[model samples]
Target: MLRLVLAVLFSGALSLPASADVSIKRLFGKEQRALNAIPQTHLVSLLERSKAAKVSSGGITYSRDWLAGQPKQSGGREWRCLAEALYFEARGESVKGQFAVAEVILNRVSSASYPDTICGVVHQGTGRKYACQFTYTCDGHAEVIAEPRAFERVGKIAKLTMKSAKRPLTKGATHYHTKAVSPYWADKFPRTATIGFHHFYKQPSRLSRN
Candidate 1:
């Protein structure tokens, strides 16, 4: 009697599900084919793009979309100084790189070794030829802003970076230079993150006369 009941139940399950089985298999097949059509590299690229689009609580999003959502920003001398520094030094860098440069400047502001303000940090060694902290200031050529759009973007970055609560990007970096040349001071300071064309550094706490 138990054998007969088990046989009936098995036969019933087999006989009633043809349409259901086909539907389930077809749906799974379509999804599998869709996934298989995407190349592995392409999938990885998509994941990276998605992560870039995410707005972080740290207030530094590396996506143009995040910048577009921000209101137009403006400020006085300090803001202008930071904006100009970024434009001349890192306008062509990636968004993350520009922020990294800004982080270095801001970090200098908070450190005892450098000036407490953005403008002061930027123009620390101006007025003498080849002696300025920033080359653009002492380069002798006119600081003509040929690219207004690029300047505007850096200006926005400057504004946001100033208002950011923390400087986590460069880890309190106080100095940075492009990878093109190994500056005399590069070996002295501890190397930090290297972003875009620049390598960032943090000076020793006591500071050096170089």
Candidate 2:
């Protein structure tokens, strides 16, 4: 059953749209509109930074500029726990992949064994030396948004996720891994979802479900 489902998702691997991830739709909340809503000031030469801009996904349109006006980060003014998770969790991945990883995180947030908040879930594996989760943040490597085009694209997806765009791709998964590394944990986990090169799993959420 898992193989059949995964094959279907992987075969039609087009760029995922905002309407594809359910957890994202619940978080972003439907305020994001307009293509050129705002300019990327952080990327402007005035800030001595590179310029960032929006990209259309063939027939799909997004609100990258609009999101620029809402600078949410882990520590920034618009700091949304989910938004921060999306930025760092999969910033290096394609927009769809980034969102895919984020859905896993959100799935965890809503699960019974993990932290209810995104920050807690993200930082859960931190400070354990080699025992931390989300290998990218604890691997002694800095997270840099080097690919501006891709980052901008993911950033927009992040914004859309914050604005209630729904696809529910992760199926309440709180864990994930890239296809390249066949982590031992993968063998132990019961797969919940798979999108692109990522696989998601659930180990329960921490929040009390009414």
Candidate 3:
């Protein structure tokens, strides 16, 4: 009698719907293919939206879209100083690279070893050959902004960094030099980050401050 009951239950189970046998992977495969069929521009727009929603330090998030939408107006003296420094030093760099350079400048302003103001720190060694903190300041060439678009981009970056963004992208580095040349001081400090064409470092004693 027990054998008869077991055989009857097994036959009834086999008669259930074939859909019940479908695996999870098979069920989701159709959905995944549909997502893959989306247009590239639409996918990119979705990604940009997600990035814009992400918050960095101090509740600031920067993206190309955000920067492009900013007003094209001049800022105060400090803003001009930072914007000019970025334009001359890293205009050709990637957007993130430009921001990294700005971080170094702001880091110096907050450090004990450097000047407290952006202009002071940027022009620290100007007028002396090979002594300027930034080469453009003492390169003996007029500081003319020939590229309006580039200046505008850096200006937005400067404003964003000065106001709401204070995250240390360069690992608390206060100094950086291009990859084409190795400066004597680079060896004296610990290397922190290498962004785009520049190598960043922080003085060993200043690590605590960073």
lDDT per residue as tens, model 2, 167-204? 35566666788788887667766788776568887653
Considering summed lDDT, which 10 consecutive residues are worst modelled in model 2? 43-52
Model-by-model lDDT, in order? 0.80, 0.55, 0.79
Q: Estimate each model's TM-score.
A: 0.73, 0.54, 0.69
Assess the local accuracy of residue 2 in candidate 2 as a C-alpha lDDT between 0 and 100: 29
The number of the candidate with the highest TM-score is 1
| Full candidate order by TM-score, most accurate first | 1, 3, 2
Report per-prediction Cα RMSD to one decimal: 11.8, 16.6, 11.9
lDDT of 3 at 120: 94
- lDDT for 113 in candidate 2 is 69
Q: Tell me the deviation in Å of residue 41 in model 2.
A: 29
| Predicted structure 2, TM vs. truth | 0.54
Candidate 1 TM-score, C-alpha based: 0.73
Question: lDDT by residue for model 3 over 92-140, one digit each (tens)?
Answer: 8766678889999998998888899999989998987767889899988
**Model 1, runs deviating above 4 Å:** 1-58
